[model samples]
Target: MNAAEPGQPADHVVLRRAGATDARPAADVWLRSFAAALPTVVSPRSADEVRGYFRDVVVPFRETWVADAGYRDGIVGVMVLADDELSQLYLAPGWRGRGLGDRFVGLAKERSPQGLTLWTFQVNKPAHRFYERHGFVAVEYTDGSGNEEREPDVRYVWRP
Candidate 1:
Protein backbone atom coordinates (compact mmCIF):
# COMPACT_ATOMS: atom_id res chain seq x y z
CA MET A 1 0.00 0.00 0.00
CA ASN A 2 1.09 3.53 -0.59
CA ALA A 3 2.44 5.25 2.50
CA ALA A 4 0.26 8.29 1.95
CA GLU A 5 -3.30 8.48 0.76
CA PRO A 6 -4.32 10.61 -2.20
CA GLY A 7 -4.38 14.33 -1.41
CA GLN A 8 -2.27 13.73 1.67
CA PRO A 9 1.26 15.02 1.86
CA ALA A 10 4.05 12.48 1.68
CA ASP A 11 5.96 12.62 4.91
CA HIS A 12 8.74 10.29 5.92
CA VAL A 13 7.73 9.18 9.38
CA VAL A 14 9.45 6.74 11.67
CA LEU A 15 7.04 4.70 13.71
CA ARG A 16 9.17 3.37 16.53
CA ARG A 17 8.88 2.09 20.05
CA ALA A 18 9.05 5.01 22.46
CA GLY A 19 11.54 5.18 25.32
CA ALA A 20 11.42 6.96 28.67
CA THR A 21 13.12 10.00 27.15
CA ASP A 22 10.21 10.42 24.75
CA ALA A 23 7.62 10.91 27.47
CA ARG A 24 7.81 14.71 27.60
CA PRO A 25 7.75 15.40 23.87
CA ALA A 26 5.15 12.71 23.33
CA ALA A 27 3.07 14.48 25.96
CA ASP A 28 3.43 17.72 24.05
CA VAL A 29 2.13 16.04 20.94
CA TRP A 30 -0.74 14.62 22.96
CA LEU A 31 -1.68 17.96 24.45
CA ARG A 32 -1.44 19.86 21.19
CA SER A 33 -3.30 17.22 19.25
CA PHE A 34 -6.04 17.07 21.85
CA ALA A 35 -6.46 20.82 21.76
CA ALA A 36 -6.55 20.80 17.99
CA ALA A 37 -8.88 17.84 17.58
CA LEU A 38 -11.24 17.80 20.54
CA PRO A 39 -11.71 21.29 21.85
CA THR A 40 -15.44 20.69 22.16
CA VAL A 41 -14.85 17.72 24.42
CA VAL A 42 -14.20 20.17 27.27
CA SER A 43 -11.51 18.48 29.28
CA PRO A 44 -11.75 19.03 33.01
CA ARG A 45 -8.01 19.48 33.37
CA SER A 46 -5.66 22.16 32.19
CA ALA A 47 -3.15 21.58 29.41
CA ASP A 48 -0.37 21.30 31.98
CA GLU A 49 -2.39 18.72 33.85
CA VAL A 50 -2.86 16.66 30.72
CA ARG A 51 0.83 17.02 29.93
CA GLY A 52 1.71 15.64 33.32
CA TYR A 53 -0.78 12.82 32.81
CA PHE A 54 0.97 11.89 29.59
CA ARG A 55 4.42 12.12 31.10
CA ASP A 56 3.76 10.52 34.47
CA VAL A 57 0.93 8.12 33.74
CA VAL A 58 0.29 7.43 30.06
CA VAL A 59 3.90 7.12 28.95
CA PRO A 60 5.09 5.24 32.02
CA PHE A 61 2.16 2.90 32.44
CA ARG A 62 1.10 2.18 28.88
CA GLU A 63 3.07 0.92 25.94
CA THR A 64 3.66 3.93 23.71
CA TRP A 65 4.54 4.14 20.07
CA VAL A 66 5.75 7.40 18.59
CA ALA A 67 5.68 8.77 15.06
CA ASP A 68 8.79 10.82 14.57
CA ALA A 69 9.42 13.19 11.73
CA GLY A 70 12.33 11.95 9.69
CA TYR A 71 15.59 13.89 10.20
CA ARG A 72 14.31 15.53 13.33
CA ASP A 73 13.67 14.55 16.94
CA GLY A 74 10.16 16.00 16.77
CA ILE A 75 7.37 13.66 17.77
CA VAL A 76 4.44 14.21 15.44
CA GLY A 77 2.13 11.52 16.76
CA VAL A 78 1.68 9.09 19.62
CA MET A 79 -0.30 5.89 20.19
CA VAL A 80 -0.71 4.35 23.60
CA LEU A 81 -1.89 0.80 24.00
CA ALA A 82 -2.77 -0.89 27.26
CA ASP A 83 -3.55 -4.55 26.82
CA ASP A 84 -6.07 -4.73 23.96
CA GLU A 85 -7.35 -1.26 24.46
CA LEU A 86 -6.04 1.60 22.32
CA SER A 87 -5.98 4.13 25.10
CA GLN A 88 -4.61 7.06 23.10
CA LEU A 89 -3.76 8.09 19.55
CA TYR A 90 -2.90 11.72 18.88
CA LEU A 91 -1.18 13.56 16.10
CA ALA A 92 0.27 17.01 16.03
CA PRO A 93 -1.87 19.68 14.39
CA GLY A 94 0.24 19.78 11.26
CA TRP A 95 0.33 16.01 10.98
CA ARG A 96 -3.39 15.40 10.78
CA GLY A 97 -4.87 13.98 7.55
CA ARG A 98 -1.41 13.00 6.39
CA GLY A 99 -1.66 9.20 6.78
CA LEU A 100 0.24 9.13 10.08
CA GLY A 101 -2.91 7.94 11.75
CA ASP A 102 -3.14 5.07 9.30
CA ARG A 103 0.41 4.11 10.16
CA PHE A 104 -0.38 4.25 13.85
CA VAL A 105 -3.49 2.09 13.43
CA GLY A 106 -1.54 -0.37 11.33
CA LEU A 107 1.04 -0.62 14.08
CA ALA A 108 -1.66 -1.05 16.68
CA LYS A 109 -3.21 -3.94 14.76
CA GLU A 110 0.18 -5.51 14.33
CA ARG A 111 0.93 -5.30 18.05
CA SER A 112 -2.45 -6.67 19.05
CA PRO A 113 -3.13 -9.21 16.36
CA GLN A 114 -6.16 -10.68 18.05
CA GLY A 115 -8.32 -7.55 18.07
CA LEU A 116 -8.35 -4.03 19.45
CA THR A 117 -10.72 -1.71 21.24
CA LEU A 118 -10.83 2.06 21.76
CA TRP A 119 -13.00 4.85 23.04
CA THR A 120 -13.68 8.15 21.29
CA PHE A 121 -15.82 10.99 22.40
CA GLN A 122 -19.20 10.87 20.71
CA VAL A 123 -18.82 14.53 19.90
CA ASN A 124 -15.70 13.79 17.90
CA LYS A 125 -17.39 13.06 14.62
CA PRO A 126 -14.13 13.21 12.70
CA ALA A 127 -12.67 10.55 14.95
CA HIS A 128 -15.81 8.44 14.64
CA ARG A 129 -15.62 8.59 10.87
CA PHE A 130 -11.92 7.87 10.85
CA TYR A 131 -12.27 4.82 13.09
CA GLU A 132 -15.25 3.55 11.11
CA ARG A 133 -13.36 3.88 7.86
CA HIS A 134 -10.56 1.90 9.45
CA GLY A 135 -12.96 -1.06 10.04
CA PHE A 136 -13.82 -0.35 13.64
CA VAL A 137 -17.43 -0.95 14.68
CA ALA A 138 -19.08 0.90 17.49
CA VAL A 139 -20.00 -1.73 20.04
CA GLU A 140 -21.19 0.47 22.87
CA TYR A 141 -22.09 4.00 23.84
CA THR A 142 -21.82 5.61 27.23
CA ASP A 143 -22.93 8.73 29.04
CA GLY A 144 -20.38 11.38 29.97
CA SER A 145 -19.09 9.85 33.16
CA GLY A 146 -16.34 7.33 32.70
CA ASN A 147 -13.88 9.73 31.09
CA GLU A 148 -11.98 12.70 32.39
CA GLU A 149 -13.48 14.95 29.75
CA ARG A 150 -16.96 13.98 30.92
CA GLU A 151 -18.02 13.74 27.33
CA PRO A 152 -20.39 11.11 26.01
CA ASP A 153 -18.34 8.46 24.27
CA VAL A 154 -18.50 5.41 22.07
CA ARG A 155 -16.45 2.26 22.16
CA TYR A 156 -15.20 0.79 18.90
CA VAL A 157 -13.75 -2.61 18.22
CA TRP A 158 -11.77 -4.00 15.30
CA ARG A 159 -11.37 -7.74 14.90
CA PRO A 160 -9.68 -9.93 12.41
Candidate 2:
Protein backbone atom coordinates (compact mmCIF):
# COMPACT_ATOMS: atom_id res chain seq x y z
CA MET A 1 0.00 0.00 0.00
CA ASN A 2 1.16 3.55 -0.62
CA ALA A 3 2.30 5.53 2.39
CA ALA A 4 -0.05 8.23 1.17
CA GLU A 5 -3.08 6.00 1.61
CA PRO A 6 -5.52 6.26 4.48
CA GLY A 7 -4.13 5.30 7.89
CA GLN A 8 -0.65 5.53 6.39
CA PRO A 9 0.28 9.16 6.62
CA ALA A 10 2.75 10.35 4.05
CA ASP A 11 4.88 11.44 6.98
CA HIS A 12 5.91 7.82 7.12
CA VAL A 13 7.64 8.27 3.83
CA VAL A 14 11.30 8.34 4.67
CA LEU A 15 13.53 10.52 2.57
CA ARG A 16 17.16 9.42 2.28
CA ARG A 17 20.15 9.69 0.02
CA ALA A 18 19.95 7.24 -2.84
CA GLY A 19 22.61 4.62 -3.32
CA ALA A 20 23.69 2.71 -6.41
CA THR A 21 21.38 -0.12 -5.41
CA ASP A 22 18.52 2.35 -5.53
CA ALA A 23 19.15 3.28 -9.15
CA ARG A 24 16.68 0.78 -10.60
CA PRO A 25 13.93 1.44 -8.07
CA ALA A 26 14.40 5.19 -8.26
CA ALA A 27 14.29 4.99 -12.03
CA ASP A 28 11.08 3.02 -11.80
CA VAL A 29 9.57 5.68 -9.59
CA TRP A 30 10.66 8.36 -12.04
CA LEU A 31 9.16 6.50 -14.98
CA ARG A 32 5.83 5.84 -13.30
CA SER A 33 5.53 9.36 -11.98
CA PHE A 34 6.51 10.90 -15.28
CA ALA A 35 4.00 8.78 -17.19
CA ALA A 36 1.26 9.66 -14.75
CA ALA A 37 1.98 13.34 -14.33
CA LEU A 38 3.11 14.41 -17.77
CA PRO A 39 1.02 12.51 -20.24
CA THR A 40 1.23 15.30 -22.77
CA VAL A 41 4.98 15.43 -22.83
CA VAL A 42 6.73 12.51 -24.41
CA SER A 43 9.94 11.18 -22.91
CA PRO A 44 12.74 10.59 -25.35
CA ARG A 45 14.56 8.05 -23.25
CA SER A 46 13.63 4.42 -23.07
CA ALA A 47 13.14 2.60 -19.76
CA ASP A 48 16.53 0.95 -20.01
CA GLU A 49 18.12 4.26 -20.89
CA VAL A 50 16.59 5.94 -17.87
CA ARG A 51 17.78 3.14 -15.63
CA GLY A 52 21.25 3.39 -17.10
CA TYR A 53 21.28 7.12 -16.51
CA PHE A 54 20.34 6.67 -12.86
CA ARG A 55 22.95 3.99 -12.48
CA ASP A 56 25.81 5.74 -14.28
CA VAL A 57 25.08 9.41 -13.56
CA VAL A 58 22.36 10.26 -11.08
CA VAL A 59 23.14 7.86 -8.25
CA PRO A 60 26.84 8.39 -8.72
CA PHE A 61 27.10 12.12 -9.31
CA ARG A 62 23.88 13.89 -8.35
CA GLU A 63 22.65 14.44 -4.83
CA THR A 64 19.77 12.05 -5.28
CA TRP A 65 17.02 11.49 -2.75
CA VAL A 66 14.48 8.70 -2.64
CA ALA A 67 11.39 8.29 -0.51
CA ASP A 68 11.17 4.81 0.89
CA ALA A 69 7.57 3.72 1.35
CA GLY A 70 8.28 1.26 4.09
CA TYR A 71 10.12 -2.01 3.49
CA ARG A 72 7.50 -3.28 1.08
CA ASP A 73 6.85 -0.32 -1.16
CA GLY A 74 10.49 0.43 -1.71
CA ILE A 75 11.03 3.78 -3.42
CA VAL A 76 7.92 5.72 -4.30
CA GLY A 77 9.54 9.07 -4.90
CA VAL A 78 12.73 10.46 -6.36
CA MET A 79 14.43 13.85 -6.32
CA VAL A 80 17.71 15.04 -7.79
CA LEU A 81 19.77 18.07 -6.87
CA ALA A 82 22.47 19.22 -9.27
CA ASP A 83 24.25 22.03 -7.51
CA ASP A 84 21.57 24.70 -6.93
CA GLU A 85 19.16 23.22 -9.39
CA LEU A 86 16.36 20.89 -8.37
CA SER A 87 16.71 18.88 -11.54
CA GLN A 88 14.02 16.36 -10.67
CA LEU A 89 11.19 15.62 -8.28
CA TYR A 90 8.73 12.85 -9.00
CA LEU A 91 6.38 10.84 -6.82
CA ALA A 92 4.36 7.74 -7.52
CA PRO A 93 0.92 8.53 -8.87
CA GLY A 94 -0.76 7.44 -5.67
CA TRP A 95 1.68 9.50 -3.64
CA ARG A 96 0.76 12.82 -5.15
CA GLY A 97 -1.05 15.54 -3.12
CA ARG A 98 0.67 14.33 0.01
CA GLY A 99 2.93 16.52 2.13
CA LEU A 100 5.92 14.59 0.79
CA GLY A 101 6.35 17.08 -2.01
CA ASP A 102 6.51 19.89 0.52
CA ARG A 103 9.03 17.94 2.55
CA PHE A 104 11.11 17.32 -0.54
CA VAL A 105 11.06 20.99 -1.39
CA GLY A 106 12.03 21.83 2.16
CA LEU A 107 14.96 19.47 1.93
CA ALA A 108 15.93 20.96 -1.38
CA LYS A 109 15.95 24.40 0.19
CA GLU A 110 18.10 23.19 3.05
CA ARG A 111 20.52 21.67 0.55
CA SER A 112 20.64 24.90 -1.43
CA PRO A 113 19.62 27.62 0.99
CA GLN A 114 20.58 30.46 -1.30
CA GLY A 115 18.30 29.41 -4.14
CA LEU A 116 17.04 26.56 -6.31
CA THR A 117 16.08 26.36 -9.94
CA LEU A 118 13.98 23.84 -11.89
CA TRP A 119 12.32 23.37 -15.22
CA THR A 120 8.95 21.85 -16.07
CA PHE A 121 6.99 21.47 -19.23
CA GLN A 122 4.57 24.25 -20.03
CA VAL A 123 1.76 21.71 -20.11
CA ASN A 124 2.43 20.65 -16.53
CA LYS A 125 0.10 23.14 -14.87
CA PRO A 126 0.05 21.22 -11.59
CA ALA A 127 3.82 21.37 -11.35
CA HIS A 128 3.78 25.08 -12.14
CA ARG A 129 1.29 25.71 -9.33
CA PHE A 130 3.10 23.42 -6.92
CA TYR A 131 6.42 25.20 -7.46
CA GLU A 132 4.79 28.61 -7.22
CA ARG A 133 3.20 27.68 -3.91
CA HIS A 134 6.70 26.89 -2.67
CA GLY A 135 7.98 30.37 -3.69
CA PHE A 136 9.37 29.34 -7.07
CA VAL A 137 8.81 32.07 -9.63
CA ALA A 138 8.76 31.56 -13.36
CA VAL A 139 11.94 33.21 -14.58
CA GLU A 140 12.05 32.10 -18.19
CA TYR A 141 10.12 30.39 -20.94
CA THR A 142 11.56 28.53 -23.86
CA ASP A 143 10.34 27.15 -27.13
CA GLY A 144 10.48 23.42 -27.95
CA SER A 145 14.02 23.49 -29.25
CA GLY A 146 16.62 23.25 -26.53
CA ASN A 147 15.37 20.14 -24.78
CA GLU A 148 15.41 16.56 -25.99
CA GLU A 149 11.68 16.27 -25.55
CA ARG A 150 11.17 19.28 -27.77
CA GLU A 151 8.36 20.50 -25.57
CA PRO A 152 7.93 24.04 -24.40
CA ASP A 153 9.30 24.36 -20.86
CA VAL A 154 9.32 27.03 -18.18
CA ARG A 155 12.15 27.66 -15.77
CA TYR A 156 11.34 28.48 -12.16
CA VAL A 157 13.66 29.78 -9.50
CA TRP A 158 13.25 29.86 -5.73
CA ARG A 159 15.19 32.58 -3.91
CA PRO A 160 15.74 32.35 -0.23
Candidate 3:
Protein backbone atom coordinates (compact mmCIF):
# COMPACT_ATOMS: atom_id res chain seq x y z
CA MET A 1 0.00 0.00 0.00
CA ASN A 2 1.10 3.52 -0.65
CA ALA A 3 2.03 5.58 2.37
CA ALA A 4 -0.60 8.05 1.35
CA GLU A 5 -3.36 5.47 1.35
CA PRO A 6 -4.60 4.04 4.65
CA GLY A 7 -6.69 1.08 5.81
CA GLN A 8 -5.90 -1.23 2.92
CA PRO A 9 -4.86 -4.89 3.16
CA ALA A 10 -1.33 -4.18 4.29
CA ASP A 11 -2.56 -1.74 6.86
CA HIS A 12 -5.53 -3.47 8.41
CA VAL A 13 -6.34 -6.89 6.98
CA VAL A 14 -5.08 -9.70 9.13
CA LEU A 15 -5.51 -13.30 8.09
CA ARG A 16 -5.79 -15.67 11.00
CA ARG A 17 -7.22 -19.02 12.00
CA ALA A 18 -10.97 -19.05 12.42
CA GLY A 19 -11.90 -19.53 16.03
CA ALA A 20 -15.17 -20.90 17.37
CA THR A 21 -16.40 -17.38 17.95
CA ASP A 22 -15.66 -16.43 14.38
CA ALA A 23 -18.08 -18.94 12.96
CA ARG A 24 -21.08 -16.70 12.54
CA PRO A 25 -19.20 -13.66 11.25
CA ALA A 26 -17.24 -15.77 8.78
CA ALA A 27 -20.41 -17.48 7.64
CA ASP A 28 -22.02 -14.11 7.13
CA VAL A 29 -19.22 -13.13 4.80
CA TRP A 30 -19.67 -16.37 2.88
CA LEU A 31 -23.40 -15.86 2.64
CA ARG A 32 -23.14 -12.30 1.42
CA SER A 33 -20.38 -13.13 -1.01
CA PHE A 34 -22.21 -16.09 -2.44
CA ALA A 35 -25.34 -14.06 -2.95
CA ALA A 36 -23.46 -11.20 -4.58
CA ALA A 37 -21.14 -13.30 -6.71
CA LEU A 38 -23.40 -16.14 -7.69
CA PRO A 39 -26.87 -14.67 -7.74
CA THR A 40 -28.25 -17.28 -10.11
CA VAL A 41 -26.96 -20.31 -8.24
CA VAL A 42 -29.07 -21.86 -5.55
CA SER A 43 -27.53 -22.59 -2.19
CA PRO A 44 -28.65 -25.90 -0.80
CA ARG A 45 -28.35 -24.78 2.80
CA SER A 46 -30.30 -22.18 4.73
CA ALA A 47 -28.64 -19.39 6.73
CA ASP A 48 -28.85 -21.36 9.94
CA GLU A 49 -27.53 -24.45 8.20
CA VAL A 50 -24.54 -22.51 6.93
CA ARG A 51 -23.81 -21.05 10.34
CA GLY A 52 -24.01 -24.51 11.84
CA TYR A 53 -21.67 -25.83 9.17
CA PHE A 54 -19.21 -23.15 10.07
CA ARG A 55 -19.48 -23.84 13.76
CA ASP A 56 -19.82 -27.63 13.74
CA VAL A 57 -17.80 -28.52 10.70
CA VAL A 58 -15.61 -25.85 9.13
CA VAL A 59 -13.98 -24.15 12.10
CA PRO A 60 -13.69 -27.34 14.08
CA PHE A 61 -12.65 -29.77 11.36
CA ARG A 62 -11.10 -27.81 8.53
CA GLU A 63 -8.35 -25.27 8.18
CA THR A 64 -10.59 -22.24 8.23
CA TRP A 65 -9.27 -18.70 8.07
CA VAL A 66 -10.84 -15.30 8.42
CA ALA A 67 -9.70 -12.01 7.01
CA ASP A 68 -10.32 -9.60 9.81
CA ALA A 69 -10.28 -6.17 8.28
CA GLY A 70 -9.83 -4.36 11.53
CA TYR A 71 -12.56 -2.56 13.49
CA ARG A 72 -14.12 -0.89 10.49
CA ASP A 73 -14.46 -3.95 8.30
CA GLY A 74 -14.68 -6.62 10.98
CA ILE A 75 -14.76 -10.06 9.39
CA VAL A 76 -14.46 -9.23 5.73
CA GLY A 77 -13.68 -12.59 4.22
CA VAL A 78 -13.39 -16.31 4.86
CA MET A 79 -11.37 -19.14 3.38
CA VAL A 80 -11.63 -22.83 4.11
CA LEU A 81 -9.04 -25.39 3.16
CA ALA A 82 -9.74 -29.12 3.26
CA ASP A 83 -6.28 -30.60 2.83
CA ASP A 84 -5.23 -29.63 -0.68
CA GLU A 85 -8.65 -28.41 -1.66
CA LEU A 86 -9.39 -24.72 -1.40
CA SER A 87 -12.92 -25.55 -0.47
CA GLN A 88 -14.11 -21.99 0.09
CA LEU A 89 -12.98 -18.40 -0.52
CA TYR A 90 -15.35 -15.51 -0.15
CA LEU A 91 -14.99 -11.82 0.58
CA ALA A 92 -17.66 -9.48 1.83
CA PRO A 93 -19.45 -7.80 -1.05
CA GLY A 94 -18.01 -4.39 -0.26
CA TRP A 95 -14.58 -5.81 0.35
CA ARG A 96 -14.12 -7.13 -3.17
CA GLY A 97 -11.34 -5.64 -5.40
CA ARG A 98 -9.23 -4.61 -2.46
CA GLY A 99 -6.70 -7.47 -2.71
CA LEU A 100 -8.07 -9.47 0.26
CA GLY A 101 -9.02 -12.36 -2.00
CA ASP A 102 -5.58 -12.32 -3.55
CA ARG A 103 -4.02 -12.37 -0.11
CA PHE A 104 -6.19 -15.33 0.83
CA VAL A 105 -5.16 -17.24 -2.28
CA GLY A 106 -1.52 -16.47 -1.59
CA LEU A 107 -1.93 -17.71 1.95
CA ALA A 108 -3.61 -20.88 0.68
CA LYS A 109 -0.73 -21.60 -1.69
CA GLU A 110 1.75 -20.94 1.08
CA ARG A 111 -0.09 -23.32 3.38
CA SER A 112 -0.36 -25.99 0.69
CA PRO A 113 2.89 -25.35 -1.10
CA GLN A 114 2.84 -28.49 -3.20
CA GLY A 115 -0.46 -27.60 -4.88
CA LEU A 116 -4.02 -26.62 -4.37
CA THR A 117 -7.33 -27.39 -6.07
CA LEU A 118 -10.62 -25.52 -5.99
CA TRP A 119 -14.07 -25.51 -7.50
CA THR A 120 -16.21 -22.59 -8.60
CA PHE A 121 -19.51 -22.31 -10.36
CA GLN A 122 -18.92 -21.99 -14.09
CA VAL A 123 -21.03 -18.87 -14.15
CA ASN A 124 -18.82 -17.09 -11.62
CA LYS A 125 -16.58 -15.56 -14.22
CA PRO A 126 -14.96 -13.24 -11.71
CA ALA A 127 -13.89 -16.19 -9.59
CA HIS A 128 -12.58 -17.99 -12.67
CA ARG A 129 -10.54 -14.94 -13.59
CA PHE A 130 -9.31 -14.38 -10.05
CA TYR A 131 -8.13 -17.96 -9.58
CA GLU A 132 -6.59 -18.10 -13.01
CA ARG A 133 -4.72 -14.88 -12.27
CA HIS A 134 -3.36 -16.56 -9.17
CA GLY A 135 -1.81 -19.36 -11.22
CA PHE A 136 -4.62 -21.90 -10.98
CA VAL A 137 -5.55 -23.70 -14.20
CA ALA A 138 -8.82 -25.25 -15.19
CA VAL A 139 -8.54 -29.04 -15.12
CA GLU A 140 -12.11 -30.23 -15.40
CA TYR A 141 -15.71 -29.19 -15.82
CA THR A 142 -18.76 -30.98 -14.46
CA ASP A 143 -22.36 -30.91 -15.58
CA GLY A 144 -23.88 -29.82 -12.26
CA SER A 145 -24.73 -33.39 -11.26
CA GLY A 146 -22.24 -34.00 -8.46
CA ASN A 147 -22.79 -30.82 -6.48
CA GLU A 148 -25.60 -29.90 -4.14
CA GLU A 149 -26.38 -26.77 -6.11
CA ARG A 150 -26.70 -28.71 -9.35
CA GLU A 151 -24.89 -25.87 -11.05
CA PRO A 152 -22.26 -26.38 -13.70
CA ASP A 153 -18.87 -26.11 -12.06
CA VAL A 154 -15.21 -26.01 -12.97
CA ARG A 155 -12.24 -27.35 -11.10
CA TYR A 156 -8.92 -25.54 -10.96
CA VAL A 157 -5.50 -26.81 -9.98
CA TRP A 158 -2.34 -24.98 -9.02
CA ARG A 159 1.02 -26.71 -8.83
CA PRO A 160 4.15 -25.25 -7.42
| The candidate that achieves the highest lDDT relative to the unseen native structure | 2
lDDT of 3 by residue, 1-160 (tens): 1121443444478899999999999998899999999999989999999999999999999999998866755788899999999999998877788888889898999999999999999999999999999999999999989999999999999999
RMSD for all candidates, in order, please.
Answer: 4.0, 1.5, 3.6
How well does each candidate superpose onto the true structure, as a TM-score?
0.89, 0.95, 0.93
Question: Using TM-score as the measure, what is the rank order of every candidate, best first?
Answer: 2, 3, 1
RMSD of 1: 4.0
Residue 59 of model 2, lDDT score:
95
> Tens digits of per-residue lDDT for model 2 on 1-160?
4345554568777999999899999999899999998888889999999999999999999999999887767898999999999999998888888788999999999999999999999999999999999999999999979899999999999998
Where does model 2 exceed 4 Å of error?
Answer: 1-7
Regions more than 4 Å wrong, model 3: 1-10
